[model samples]
Target chain A: MTCKECRKRFVEARYGELNAGQRAEFEAHLQGCAACAAEYRRLQQTLRIMDQREQPRLESDFGDAFWDKLAAKLDAEDAPPAPRPPQRETPARVLRMFDWPRASRIAAAAAVLVIGVLIGRYFFSRGGEEIPLAGSRETLLQPTALEVRAGDYLEKSKVLLLGLVNWEAETPEAVALDFPRYQRASRDLLQEAGYLKTALEDSRQRRLRALVADLEVVLLQIANLEAENDLSAIEMVKTGVDRRGILLKINLEEIRRAQSLPRPGQTSGKPSI
Target chain B: MKDEKELIERAQRGEMGAFRELVERYQKTVYFLALDLCGCRQDAEDISQEVFLKAYRFLPNFRGEARLSSWLYRITVNCFMDTRRKTQLQTLSLHNDAPGENHPPELSLPDPGADPSAPARSHELQQLIRRALGRLSPRERSVFVLRHYQELPLKEIGEMLEIAEGTVKALLFRAIKRLQKELAIYQAEV
Candidate 1:
């Protein structure tokens, strides 16, 4: 080989990693060539000196000092890391002192607000459409059939609720109405309805249960008034019936509107209600 | 060995004391290796600190299949390489002995300026070799340092570098060739 090839092999040889035959050939070449021999000697000397060079030493206190400083910084960072707690944990507890006396009182207030909202929305969305009265020239009177149907819906709801709660000892017929046995079952069905106002699944069962719960509440109020034998209680019942009658009308309209919307299996564009 | 394993297990459980012990025991090796890779003392110190900090952060994920030193070295090398890439600063100046006319005995080498066999130049020549090493690519410098100066076996160097043995060999060969070229120039200058 040439001088460059020999020098390359010589470099490899300096590490004592050359193969035996190559080492022999390299030795012969080194004996013959003064420059290669001199180069080999110098390279060996460099390698030996490198072996003797001291590894760098760090400051003796580096670890302790570093940890001390780092720990202090980390401690400072961690001191106040937690955020303020949110107020949502016990919502009922928070509102306890400021709220209505009982669940029923809250329910009655909510019912009033809901009824007021529905009435206002209905008037606003109507845009003054002329609704003629029966046997009169009044341009904004509701139909008598609608009025009768509204009364029937409320009356039926009262009967159903009486059946739902088995409201009185005398109401054996209401108790025999195949009423729902558990409030939890009704709650689960209500959950599936997607709203208190409608049922999207098992509509027959949901409707029956909802109608029963409503009727039971009304009947329970009547029974309480009758048991007390108080005329003032009768007036309270009258007010409840009047307000509930209007809600039943609005709810029936909403139920009609919902039923008219496209159902899963029916192709008809019209509502069954 | 079981003590190390138990310590690692405790460290994995978020035990700060156990982790600190691990750091204290291994800090010297980590710092020296960092210094070897990055010639700047400050960069070495920084890399060493980062390696320990990162080890603590990733402690729970350590599976204990490999020695902690090997795993730590892997992280250290990555951290050093990342810093080197970001700075693009070569680290030759760290080895430039603190400037003084005073020379130590074991380190002396021949000086062409003085007697033909002058010993001071030998140490200076060794320093020159180290300085010229900075001109090499990090991979070449790494392979050269690990193979020659560190006297690490090629296979272990391959493991530390995460490269195939043949590739390490090729890189080491190229590095030696470059060093020889630089050394030849230095010899002529002398």
Candidate 2:
């Protein structure tokens, strides 16, 4: 055996871990190589010194105290958690099944899809011929259908409010305004206003929506008037119409709707008469 | 062997008394092994406790493929390495260990009846050796202690440490070379 090989096996050699054949080879090398033999001797001496030093003594062992301490810790681990007040299960538990970004993406995608479908139906849906949710895309997207309907409602509301605001009688019986006939007409218009209010919810015409809502409130008050001589109630309705400038707004909107771009196949938006 | 097999079965079956008996059989061996690795009485105790706790928790997974002591030995080494990682590392000093300054851990107190200077020489040698051990990194220290103190075979040491046998030999040689350098003075004296 070479000196390098013998030195490499110094630990195994000193500890007597070598087999008989290897030990014989190692011994044969040591006999011939003085440097390797001296190094081997030094290793043996160092380990001898280590062997002579006694290990430090500790007074304790894994006694009853240690076992008891460990046992208590184990018991605590095994114990069930404290009870909580019963609560309805929340979606938070379901949400925990997915990571945050993935769950949020799923939710956002669903919301966008639902909204896209609704807006698509609101604009392009002419599939079901009988149950048309909104008008055709062109009628709704262009300013034709909504503006025309709003203009008609404004004209009727303007005539009714004008007749009421005109009668400023000093005494209740002196009023010559026809309250019964106007209230009957207003009740009918009030029902139509409810439908228009719902239809106009997603409409782009904010000004028209505001005017219709205000007119509905006034019409409702007028329809509920008690008698023909209830001048106080009529004055309240008239005051509201004046305060809101309902007449001027309706007149201006009617003129704009008349002048707005004409719908397809119609040469003029203006009234023929 | 049969009795050990039965004990392992009982312990696996959640018999607390059987588990304690198993602990009782190997407690000192594990404690001293930990004591040799860490060079502190308190850390040795903590490592021993953690080893058993882990062993109990994982008892159901034990497949009876190896001796229980071998399994516990692996856990003890892993726990030592883990404690080293998680705790703020400080240099290990035998002087500061709980064994007191006069008696450095892993080095016995000088016997009163012996030749006076022999104890001093032995103590000085032990101090130098432990200081040199402290200078080695954690992996070197573990390899040295397992081979030197635990008398583990080089192959078994490799298997237990999840390293190749050749790697174990390399680490062991590196550890011994460092020790030899630290003890050059003693080698000259001898």
Q: Which ten residues in a row have the lowest lDDT in candidate 2 chain B?
A: B100-109
Superposed by TM-score, candidate 2 places the C-alpha of residue A58 at a distance from the truth, in angstroms, of 3.2
How does model 1 score on DockQ? Answer: 0.08
lDDT of each: 0.58, 0.72
**Backbone Cα, N, C clashes tallied per candidate:** 11, 0
- lDDT tens digits, residue span B128-159, model 2: 76666665667777888888887888888899
Kindly list the per-residue Cα lDDT of model 1 for residues B1-190, writing each as its tens digit: 3499999999899788887889888988887677666655567778888888788778899998878987887787788789878985445432334455123322122322444563765557656655556546778877777678656667777898889977887787776656666566665664
Task: Report the lDDT tens digits of candidate 2 across residue range A213-262.
Answer: 98999999999988877778888887898898888888888777756757
Candidate number achieving the greatest TM-score relative to the actual structure: 2
Candidate 2 global Cα RMSD = 24.4
